[model samples]
Target: MTTTYDPTHPRYDNEGDMRDELLRVYDLCHGCRLCFNLCPSFPSLFEAIDAHDGDVEALSVAEQDKVVDECYQCKLCYVKCPYVPPHEWELDFPRLMLRNTAVRRKHDGLRAKLTDQALGRTDLVGTLSTMVAPLANAVTQTPGSLPRRVMEKVTGIAAERMLPPYARQRFSTWFKKRVTPTLTRRQGSVTVFPTCLVEYQNP
Candidate 1:
């Protein structure tokens, strides 16, 4: 009965469990349709469900993947949903999309693209890749290299695609260890709320 989006969950990588969770949430989405216009995934999901005469369980693996692939985690649907969390449905669209990618990476392995795996675990990948930044950078930046060629075959990402390099240290880590800049004049402090995209695009 649990619909966990946490990768740490025991069932997180189970294909059958993932499918059940998808059906549960997709059914909720189908019944409501409040956020259909929020993204391309919803319209495609609704269309497929309707084609099956409103039976969400009738959706094939390919059809389910169609919706999962369309979601880019903008999270507008989660904000717009009335059945989120405390409502007992525990509906979390963005996290569910994340779970789908994580499950695919673990279960599908070679078939699961590197871009999808890297995008989902920005923090983990950034930290680990930063430890070997030069080598990682070289492989990802140089498309025709032997490492990249092997990478493409193993992870299904094209050798020609350039992955952004990981920074030497996480921005937060750098900011904390940085020497405090003295202000010569009175200045107002501001906070930045950058999207997840900024995690990999560090300075």
Candidate 2:
């Protein structure tokens, strides 16, 4: 079934405000293509925006999922933008992209599926790596294989990409081996958020 967002659709409480803002940013696109030079996804994004109209789904559920997979979650585009609007203004393109991701998640529920199955269960991933790591490496490294070729075609991750070898010991394991006493901070407590990448990626 082909489902599309409609202006009168009851699912959209915010109407097309998000979509309009995104399109507005695209309208402001100077055609300088600064973001294009930063990441592979940007080039695709540039093309999408160049052609996208009010009715098109340039950043829909399926399309956004593809973007999430293809993009390496790099902030290079954000840094390279010449006219990146501040949050106080309503013209932040990066912020718009992040909001688009959230809307996709809220509307389509793909983010939960991806995260719960692939991202949330680190322990399960670690367990699977014991078997899949070698096979993944071989398939990717092999010159002519269905798995290697198919993986490359579907994911855009290069078959010959030099993936890091799985560490023999996990961080917690290494941390447990240390005999040094833990030091307590005498001053203010600090919260180290691992969400920088997440924020940047979606944004």
Candidate 3:
């Protein structure tokens, strides 16, 4: 069986529909501990349901939120799950976690919604930070810095968590400057697309 994903499907729009699907997927995952070590999200979900006597519905929304929050979209579970869609089980743990997070954000408070929006716009943040890379790097490195303290208080990011430093030059800029023109025409052209981590944090 081939798995299909449709972004514009009604299930994505209907909160009740998404919630039912989420519960269904969670129930299936509860029975299969195959992905227990793939990521933190699975253990958190399993522990919560086990605490409620294997009753997923008995877990509160906040408990569910905890499970979703633990998932950082590592996609390791997708690679490990034998029941991934096309299989009769149709379990897609990472997508389920993403859907769960979307639903949660829809009902989240203003502060949470704002913080998530900011975090998700990595391109915008990277560009702005790169413009002031020196100051931004200094701020991130300074222990107990005022900006760091303020960020922690406002966004709930732990003060001790070392933030990624901005690059003095953006990745695109560096890549463009470093690329040398070939004297002879190449047989094939290549394009490179860097992820947010490579573009900003590791550039």
Computed on alpha carbons, the lDDT of every model, listed in order, comes to: 0.82, 0.51, 0.78
Q: What is the TM-score of each candidate against the true structure?
A: 0.59, 0.45, 0.68
Native-referenced Cα lDDT, model 2: 0.51
Per-residue CA lDDT of candidate 3, range 40-129, in tens?
A: 888998999999999988878778778888888899888988888688878887887777676667777876866776687899989888
Clash count per candidate: 0, 0, 0
Screening candidate 2 with a backbone cut-off below 3 angstroms (N, C-alpha, C), the clashing residue pairs are: none
lDDT of 2 by residue, 1-203 (tens): 11223435453334266665554555454355666666666565566655565333455645434533455656666676666545433344444555556565566554355544554565665555534656644654565467756655554445565544444344444455879656675665655443322222211
Question: Largest TM-score belongs to which candidate?
Answer: 3
| Count of clashing pairs, candidate 2 | 0
List the lowest-lDDT window of 10 residues for candidate 2: 194-203
Predicted candidate 1 versus true structure: per-residue lDDT over 1-203, tens digit per residue: 45887778887778887789899999999999999899899999999999999999999999998899999789999899999988898999888888877777666654465656755686687778877888788778897788988887776778888777767666666666889789999899878664444544464
Predicted model with the maximum lDDT: 1
Preferred candidate (lDDT higher): 1 or 2? 1
Candidate 3, residue 113: how far the Cα is off, in Å: 2.0
